[model samples]
Target: MAQRLADLADQGCPNFFDSQRFGKDNSNLKRLAQWINGDINVTKRHEKSLLLSALRAAEFNRQLGQRVQNRTWQTLVPGDVAILDGSNSHFSVASVDAELSARAAANDIHPAGVLPGADDSIAGAPPLLAELMQRERLQRAYRPLRLRIQQLAWQFVADDLILTMRLPRGAYASGVIRHIFDLQSD
Candidate 1:
């Protein structure tokens, strides 16, 4: 399927087509290039359709990109992610924190009691305790899958694009996309 789309995109697909995940058919696709031109003419419907296709494309891109990213634990400080080193041990960092959170929530964990906010003062508390709280929260966020990698392969058709992502066992390919979309997983 992707090979076909790649061929189509390379030559310019002569007709509109859609991947079931993206849409039925995009009437607005032709208009996407209009924004780059000077003085565009668009009726209300054309503008709306164009906007929809662009939005869908943006969403598709976002999800596709995450496939190569590492899944982190949640209860983090709202920034940064928990990355796993080759040893499979986890470390924390900034960026893609939402992915961490989603992983945690999926595992039925939350950050509330895990993180020791600055105000926390317990007698002889280990300095690392605070850090541990934050990371443990991330551990809970894991979605039952051990650390793994996902990848998105793309095929562009003259009409539209098809995106593909393969996930690890116990991980949901579509569930990952739900990170960006409000749509329920079927």
Candidate 2:
């Protein structure tokens, strides 16, 4: 599909085929290791095997970054909270405000056990989609962007090989950047 798009005179999908996708590594990788095989409680070789699988996943993501190297940055400001506004636009940053900020925490909570009165029909839903819905939601931690991420702002720069996201005390900037940056090890 990508190769086909490349052949087009005008090129491929502007937002995805030619846009940057930064994936993040779990900061808890070390801790997860301890829980899996660091001589904790009952350790099993299987735990180590699973850990290896995780490492492989992270490594694979790193390789994906290389694949998207030619992708462009859609109007995404450095500190912007790039929210996926559906498949139409890659993302649109919402200026942080008390009202918008109020929903931040709620949105980040991963759904666990069923809601008190929620219907369990779970019918007509794909198990995968349902599970994904139950997965914890990512919180926005981007400090209000100092500027707009205009497509024509400047030549997209891929500066630091090691990128650092300093989010607000209560925000999850990484939560947002995780979607675009490679936070995994090579």
Candidate 3:
């Protein structure tokens, strides 16, 4: 078990926003779509903010999921936005060079996915997400496609496994856990 956990740590995990971000049973997403279509009204400022956040998160997940499925989530590709490790700083990748590849392998940087917003270009964005960005007047953003686990350690004690690791803010612990275990909710 420890070996398996260590392997996962070395491999890192997909930097996906946990399902909880979308609210129970993805209610927030449902509400956001309803609000967008004028089928429901979101009057409270806080509620509106939550819905918007969920909207952005959902879009980010969609883009990230695509990369994961394509097996490119951990590697650089032309036109990718690469975020420097441990910082929000990012730049567009015109090409993938040897140095960039080394940095990515060492966890110095990671490929980023778009969080669509009003200022973000609609090019390359899915039609529905682009329309939502235009409608919501959102700001452009990017998130890393892979999350590196820091200070990872684990131990087994009498039929239980204990794991410890540090993650950057906004990175989900479940993102790591999902790689090693199947999860269920009560």
lDDT of 2 by residue, 32-133 (tens): 444434334324656433433343333333323333463312223233343322111223334445543433222221101111111222334334323322
> In candidate 2, residue 76 scores what lDDT?
33
- lDDT by candidate, in order shown: 0.36, 0.29, 0.83
Residue lDDT tens for model 1, 70-148: 3322234443333331232344535435676665544322221111233443344445433433433322321212222
TM values, all candidates: 0.26, 0.22, 0.87
List where candidate 1 sits over 4 angstroms from the true fold: 1-30, 49-53, 67-186
Cα displacement (angstroms), candidate 1, residue 62, comes to: 3.5
Q: Candidate 3: where is the Cα deviation over 4 Å? A: 120-136, 182-186
**Model 2 per-residue lDDT at 180:** 39
Best by TM-score: 3
- lDDT-based ranking, best first? 3, 1, 2
lDDT of 3 by residue, 1-186 (tens): 677777667868889898888999999988877876768877887997788788778778888889989999999999999999989899999999999999998889999988767766534444655566676677788899898889998888999889899998998887688777856434
What residue pairs clash in candidate 3, if any at all?
118-138
Candidate with better lDDT, 1 vs 2: 1
lDDT of 3 at 186: 41
Which is superior by TM-score, 2 or 3? 3
Q: Which candidate is the best by lDDT?
A: 3
- Give me candidate 3's TM-score against the actual structure: 0.87
